[model samples]
Target: MQVTGFVPRETADLRGRAGGPLTLRYGPRAVVVVGGLPGSGKSTLLRRWDAPATLIDPRTTRLACQARMPAALPYPAYRPAVRLLHLLRTRAAFRRPGPLLVHDCGSRWWMRRALAHWARRSGRELHVVLLAVRPAEALAGQRARARTAAPRTFRLHVRRTARLLAGIERRGRAAFPGARSVLLADAVSRGRLAGVRFDAPR
Candidate 1:
């Protein structure tokens, strides 16, 4: 059997958040959810994790969909298809026998609930790693990546993400229902993380 692993000091990051090179040992039977505002470097964090787990990233699904669609087709034209496809893929990914990594913008309650349900049914802990960055910094990240959300959409993400961050700070674990715990990581701390390790806690 596997169990979540974190020393008392590390628990502060899991609850309070960031500091040094992170070595999270949440177990291979974990559903690690990485969330943040649009362009908040959720993707970067996942990419840096460099784990061998099944990664359920909507951006990857979107790019796959775009590759098959006509070059003239805009993303909005097939956004629903991409969402459905990504959802299906995520559902399928959970069936595998190891840690599952996913990225989100932190505004979708239904999605998080569904993920939590799946994790519980599979006897896995649902761990959330939320990237908390300033809205200006997030937008700058968006620019750095050369792929930005629509202005209105970004503004909405900012408001929702801000509210979510606040709730986590004020209410702690209560803010994220069903999640075993949450890690609030800033850019500097997250940047220092070498990678994630999932295995039986010793």
Candidate 2:
């Protein structure tokens, strides 16, 4: 059987991943990818984030698909189309000059590998912003939002998220092998991450 990835000791020791102050260390021309499970504040954080960067989010594509499609049609039915559009848009944006801040689902290894490869090939620094919200809190956040994920989907996300966190704790800096930081919902609410600023274009 194929084995899953393992986390290194140092990456697991990051204080930020444990709800402590996030460390921000980056070089010029960096692409920061924000990732987390559903309702883990990835979207919420990016919406208010601003920096000298291009934002790539699949939700925009999904929303555009919703606008052009029938209201009664279920989102899951058209998700493939939305994802295709998002991929197209992302590929196009990858060629553009400037830093990029990508909102992503961290559950997929392929997505992470792609971003890492692109950053390496382009001579750009790659950074990961991981949202580390608890499963129960993430579920609560889904309810607080106007749209909620299906229960089964949410459960799947929770399982993947748990594994991701475990990997981070076990792997250390090598967990992502690039600049990495973690954000906890509770910590953000308490103003613990006041030093870090991520602004979105107005």
Candidate 3:
């Protein structure tokens, strides 16, 4: 999404709350909102961590595994309501006490605010990670990955990804302010984040 201006540097220190692992003492009840263009490794990172997390990915919830949201609903008509319901359900599910809730979505501003509000009311911490890979690099990577799949599937994914990335670039920071945008190189090299940190209530 060509994230320019005020590129953040690596985090100097990331000690846990009480000088320990950044484990949630209140409970494993927290949320990690991950946002980025397709092929930016958002899913990869979540898979790599493999933490006991409740993921709220629309593609997964809609078309892949469970039909949390009906597939028949047109995108524009059903998206907002479905997403709201998903967030609500996910939050309520964690209310009884469970692992961290990781929402692997676009990480748009509205989504971030909703999650942050939920966290505060539920007394959970919110962590945001933005996977800011260059558009060209991401597109190339996506295309390469798609080649392994069926032609029809690959074409659909590529087209959808292009649209999503374009939306993010057009929206800019207004799309996701709580997120810390990091280039692929920086994320890989430093293994840390640099960008303005947004407190939960922001």
What is the lDDT of every predicted structure here?
0.76, 0.63, 0.47
Candidate 2, TM-score vs. the true structure?
0.76
lDDT of 1 at 126: 80
Q: C-alpha displacement of 42 in model 3, angstroms?
A: 0.8
Q: Which stretches of model 1 miss by more than 4 angstroms?
A: 1-19, 200-202
TM-score of each: 0.88, 0.76, 0.53
Taking all chains together, the TM-score of candidate 3 against the true structure is: 0.53
The per-prediction CA RMSD against the true structure, in angstroms, equals: 4.1, 8.4, 10.0
29: Cα error in model 2, Å = 1.8
Clashes of 1: 0
Clashing pairs in 3: 8-194
lDDT, residue 97, candidate 2: 84
Q: Supply the global lDDT for candidate 3.
A: 0.47
1 against 3, candidate with superior TM-score = 1
Candidate 2: which stretches are off by over 4 Å? 1-25, 177-191, 195-202
User: How displaced is residue 17 in candidate 1, in Å?
Assistant: 7.7
| lDDT digits (tens) for residues 1-202 of candidate 2 | 2222221122322333334333233444657777777776777776654555688988788888899998999988989888888877876776788678788877676677777777777777666767776777677777788678788887877787677777766764355645444432332442233222332221
What local lDDT score does residue 112 receive in model 3, on the 0 to 100 scale?
A: 62
What is the TM-score (0 to 1) of candidate 1? 0.88
Which ranking of candidates, highest TM-score first? 1, 2, 3
Clashing pairs in 1: none
Better of 1 and 3 by lDDT: 1
